[model samples]
Target: DGYLATFDLDEYRAVKGGVAKKLYRYTNKRLWKRHRFTIGLRSLAEEKLGFKQGQFESELARSLAAPVAELQRFGIVCVIKQHGRMKQVHIAKKMKRKEAKEPSAPVPSLAKKLLDRGVDNAVELVQRFDAERIRDQIENFDDRTKNGNDVGPGWLRCAVENGYGFRKGFKPSRIVAEEQKVKSEKRRKAVADRAREDAELKTQQAADEEAFAEFLKFRNSLSENRRQELEDEALSKCSEFERNCVVKARRNDEIGMFHQLLWEQYIIPTLAED
Candidate 1:
């Protein structure tokens, strides 16, 4: 892997260090900055970590400046983003806890083998490996099993459960799509229901209009004396229930309103005014 190093001193000393000697392409510092030579892997080992380490590392460097300057080894983790969502997914095992004295959490680091996969924008994580594959490699150890030292998957779980990890929001596209789908379905069902009710109402109205017209024609055809005789005959054939309904509707009500269900098929004639 190509290496460009940095140090804390009167100024800062950043030069080729560690595995940079292994490659002829990395023989000079000039080649290290070139995009072609830079395509190869970089190291994430504490001794070999570069400025390109992610936001998590940057936060760590800022938070634990004292411990780092003391050359105290510590663990670190990073949060990444992919596809417009934040993913606080740990990749490999780093030093674990930021401070030597702190409990070891199940913090995965970007391994030296996967250094090139690291990105400066923690929001855009390198997708070279999936979370499941990386997660499978983590092993959680019990406190006492490792002699009261927090290490492994168990520590990671504890750390995350205690609020050390990142949580992401719903994907914007997915949420919008689902909301639109629900609205469309509701609109479709409402339209269908309204149409059905309108059709039924129109059919009933048409039937009522036809019945009223038929009754008017029948009444017009009969002379007043004949209509009265016919009405008397019909009333005599009616039940006590029908008689009572007619009495209740004696004023300002349609003649058809007093008809029994069985008599409804035939329209009732309206009597001519005296």
Candidate 2:
């Protein structure tokens, strides 16, 4: 395999000077693989640049200033410096200005969809890639899986990870598609089951809250002595560990709060059972 350096040909053509042109070409070839490098001037002049005659290292370095400045205008940054007795050229491409990214507010909805479709660690994936990229992958995955023969969460995850449709000339194999379809169905079912369990838990919590509120009103309406008797009865029904909690609360002067807890945890469930 060989390294590939890509640049705008028009931009390359517009840069002035032989030194600048060769410097641009050299940096472009390497900068794609690495960000920065330092090359000794003698080797750079003789081996890389192919200058007609040998010049003093300092003279060669000074000559590079104009070319380096010209190259800078075309997106490369270069500096000539002395290292002991040798002159070295430090080179790197200028970083492009990044456009402001859209905020991550929309990530949750996109992540949820991916989660339902059987992508594991969906939230992390969404956060890492951002909503726009994930959305693009989703569209690509949907298009690929439209035939519905081998389709599932695995396929979608693979599509997102590999950039199946978006990357040039890359597609998932038939075997991979079939495997993903099978795995995705299982993952989707698991996700749906968890969603159902969560909904049931929330519904139960709401019902419990309503029941507790009703019981609180009834208890408050009782005479003070009757309320004390009801709290004592509930406390007696609690486990030894729960009893210790109440005792600790009482010591901390949070007895009233613990009494309410006793009613909610013990009395409420007993009332519901009856």
Candidate 3:
């Protein structure tokens, strides 16, 4: 099989960094640029040498000579080409085919072939091979009933269940019933999983609402002295100019409305109530 050979300069840098630095000046510059070296390998030499029409092999040979030759020792052949502005290497394994011989025994029928392959159920075997045929028969029966073609409901049901075949010892109706039951179970499990996720989300929302209500109650119950201590703490956290800016920014909407209500309804009333 064809395989890729990648020579990472980082590995060489870690192992023989000093020696590599001394050999070439471009080594350090190229390492800093993060360039990677890769080569393709094939088993067949002729395929590697062969070039397609309108393809140039000489230019590729000039670009990848020493590294390509080095990889050949490991049973690898290389083919390089420029695809657009980027250069690419293709590798392939040398494959050989064996001659064919005529069969000496008689060819078995489809039913006999299935039985010989250890599948003894005739209805199951036929349905597996030609599922589209059964589907077409069912669809045709549905169309006939829709167009008033005198097909009784029982007849359509029997045709669909038995899959349009009355072979001896074939029980397609039972198989169809089992297939429907499996589909129903899969749908039921999916619905149950969705219900479980929705229930968990609802419980989390209720808990968040309760926590917010408790925080509002605690803030409302502070004494006037305690409120003054909070105001002093807030003032100490920032300069007077920053506090004035915050109060000015909140003067347009519900935030300003809340600030007014906090001073009037809670702070002033609490001092009077005390």
Q: Every model's Cα RMSD, please? A: 19.6, 20.6, 25.7
Report the C-alpha lDDT of model 1 over 1-274, residue by residue, as the tens digit: 4354411121111112332222212222333343222221222223234334545544533533342322211112222223233222222213222222311332235332122222121111214344433332222222222455333332333322222322232223434577999999999999999999999999999998787777667666868787556655666777778767765654545556454331342224332221
Worst 10 residues of 2 by lDDT: 96-105
Clashing pairs in 3: 42-77
What residue runs in model 2 are displaced by over 4 Å at the alpha carbon?
Answer: 1-5, 97-274
Tens digits of per-residue lDDT for model 3, 207-271? 86675565456545887577556544454555566556546644642233334334444445555
Clashes of 1: 12
Model 1 TM-score, all chains together: 0.34
lDDT of 1: 0.38
Which runs of model 1 end up more than 4 angstroms from their true locations?
Answer: 1-172, 248-254, 259-274
Task: For residues 88-174, write the lDDT of model 2, one tens digit per residue.
Answer: 888887764233233355557888778666665577677667566677777666655664435555466555654555434434354
Best by TM-score: 2
Worst ten in a row by lDDT for model 3: 93-102
* Candidate 3, RMSD to the unseen true structure: 25.7
